[model samples]
Target: MVDFNSTSFHPATFQLTGFPGQEAAHHWISIPFCVVYITAIVGNCTVLCIIWAERRLHQPMYLFLCMLSVNDLGMSLSTLPTVLGIFCFDVTDVAFDACLAQMFFIHSFSFMESGILLAMSFDRFVAICNPLRYAAILTNPRIVRIGLAVVIKSTSMLLPFPFLIKWLPICKGNVLSHPYCLHSDMMRLACADTTVNNIYGLFATLVTYGLDSVFIILSYVKILRTVFNIASYEQRLMALNTCVSHICAVLLFYVPIIAVAVMHRFGKSAPRLVQILLSYACLFVPPVLNPIVYSVKTKEIRKGISRIFSRDFL
Candidate 1:
């Protein structure tokens, strides 16, 4: 190991761990991981393809979904290599730069997902709360700008992470906590002062998770008020029904995130397996479930999927 105390010190490679002290079970564990990866890839790709092929689905809601699918795919592929390496091939070494890149993409995509969900919430808000203006407000040009804003905002927020990480000298062993690299985990390994990193991380978290979540809640509050004012019971149910998929998607994305955050903060005495499993849930669950939830809950998506399958195979 190079002298980490030196100003110019940097690690060439970092060791990645799958399950701590569970090497024997890595092969077994790879099964579920593989299943999740396969499902996430196929599911998200199918969503994207269906949304793309169904010209009728080129609305603000489906457009936001397309962005979500893309983000899910990015997050899944970002972790695939290190995860497969550790579990399947037993190769744990990852180049430092590669590790940083993976961390960057994973976190950026995560932020993008949050932003997309917030945008979806806004879509629902406009559709239900202000139905007449929905079309005029969420035009194709406006949707494109929102999508671009989400991408740029998420990527820009995370852009400083790599340089910030590289600046710190890591006297601690370069062994990552999980198969995939994470910004928080990387900061933990650095021996130098990480106050700036921590502060910036907190800032990013507040900007993405905190602000986006608040906006989503406010949008829903407005939606509920608008729905309640409708005269007919069936109309209210129909209005709320339209949001079921998006609501599921939001909860699926955020609940695990909240759990992981709580575990990191309060579950210091929690088992290592619990921590790792929760981390996996945060990364894997949303991507796998979002597409399935949308397909199950939205009639249009179901029809689109069936149409594609019938045309291609039957």
Candidate 2:
């Protein structure tokens, strides 16, 4: 609401600590972080490549899977620089504007990922409940619109973050909880009254994560009802089998998210590293696990990956 961007602005820089107290073991700490980041990027990319190479995967579910991978890739790339900077170079000082921008992108991609997952749930619901209409309902043009809408929604929800943070007088304290930036982490350091910022953050969380989780559950409920109506138990099991990867992905994303939220609300006395680890997992786990879940659960993706690896060996 305020034109904080009007003036030539260069706010004071902030220090990013890899581990607040255990600064001596930063390099050792980086080992796990490096593994997670590399795995997320490579795993999501492999999923994308496999889907693209296999014509049989040219369906609504795979398209949504592609969207999830893209969002995961964006998020990993977004936070990689800051995390590596703190762990490797010990470069902790980040400009005010840069910090705000990084936080904005990180949160935006996170919300975008949630939206993509919701779309994937709808894809599963349609395929399971009304198989005959799946193609017509999630055609290429419609899928494109849905993707665009997700991007728009994510941007709209998080676009104000930087500016809101800009208006905050953070000159008093710039140190954050983690090496990377986050809305909650950044807001806690603000010198001004952050009631509005806190409200907006909570509101955004409910709109994105809360509503999406509800719809995902409902989609599965309807799917279950439809599957159970089938005469054959084998047919029902096969129908539900298609959703195993999606179910795993939803758990991977939400479990860490809920953990972080609970820690923030009730675990104020908890160790800082615990909070940081949970937050990192909230972002890292889904990307790393999504591809693995799909590969293990979906026969097509597994065979496609096998063929690609066999060719590479030759």
Candidate 3:
């Protein structure tokens, strides 16, 4: 029988030669990322404050929106600090345990965000499809329940990831290619055979992200159908407009994810820099863009944000 914790197993290893001698580009990238990180924090914080203060915005839809803002804040916070640390201080050597922890949170928050998006889609579906039942279906108690479920489900699904890494005997390679430890990337460093890990990873991805995406698409499809069957052209237009921002947000988050997945699978021997850049963009861009899309498209949020700023300055 193979001992799981045996130290005799040789670790699979790789090194991230920092930016391939282009330290200048690495420094330059930090400036834009820093600006985006600050903006995302401010924007998400404003959303949260407004949602908290305003009684009118306390419904299920807005509740989900607030949760989404919180998730985005978490997603940004998980990665940006480490990224900035790498760029500013050249402190890239992360301990093995720290890397596993980072990977766990990154994956957990990512799944949480996906769950929030699914919840938002359900909110919109009810609002459009069964307007009369909307309030009853989405009461304060129910919303709270769903929120708890999101947290519980996301946390449960990703809990095994870090623990799995911790149990493995890491015999080689401490340097990660990216600023944060990505699950797949980290798995490559394990000395043990990763067939089980890969299978479980794919399962998690399919169930959480993949299933949520399918449900979101179906919700929008029904929403679009309902809108088209409406008698009023203005109503159809308004419904379509409401969905535009959501569609854009989904695309922004998922397109880069798909791109990175494809690159990882098919772009074997692709330059290390390309892989790192793709991963970095996937992590940072969606959080930066989510608040912008919502604020620009949702008048209530925009006005609420404006009021928040005005009151703060005055």
lDDT string, candidate 3, 1-314, tens digits: 22123453423332333465766677786788789889989888878888898899898878988888888898888886577877776666665556667788888888888888888889888988888999999999989899899999998999888766666555545556677778777677677778878888999999998999999999999998999899999988987786676788788778888988899789968988788778877777778888888899988888988887798899
Using lDDT, give the best candidate's number.
1
List model 2 lDDT by residue over 174-243, tens digit each: 6777788888777776667999998988899999999999999999999998998999999998988899
Residue 228 CA error for candidate 2 (Å)?
1.4
Encode model 1's per-residue lDDT on 1-314: one tens digit a residue.
53243545767788889888889988998999899999999999999989888899999999999999999999999999999989999999988889999999999999999999999999999999778999999999999999999999999999999999998887688888989999998888888889999999999999999999999999999999999999999999999999999999999999999998899899989998888889999899998999999999999999988998899896
Q: Global lDDT for candidate 1?
A: 0.92
Candidates 1 and 2: which is better by lDDT? 1
Candidate 2: global Cα-lDDT?
0.86
Residue 193's C-alpha lDDT in candidate 2? 96
Q: After superposition, how far is residue 220 of candidate 1 from its true place, in Å?
A: 0.3
Better of 1 and 3 by TM-score: 1
Per-candidate TM equals: 0.96, 0.95, 0.90
Which has the higher TM-score value, candidate number 1 or candidate number 2? 1
Candidate 1, residue 306: Cα displacement in angstroms equals 2.0
- The candidate maximizing TM-score is 1
As a TM-score, model 1 comes out at: 0.96
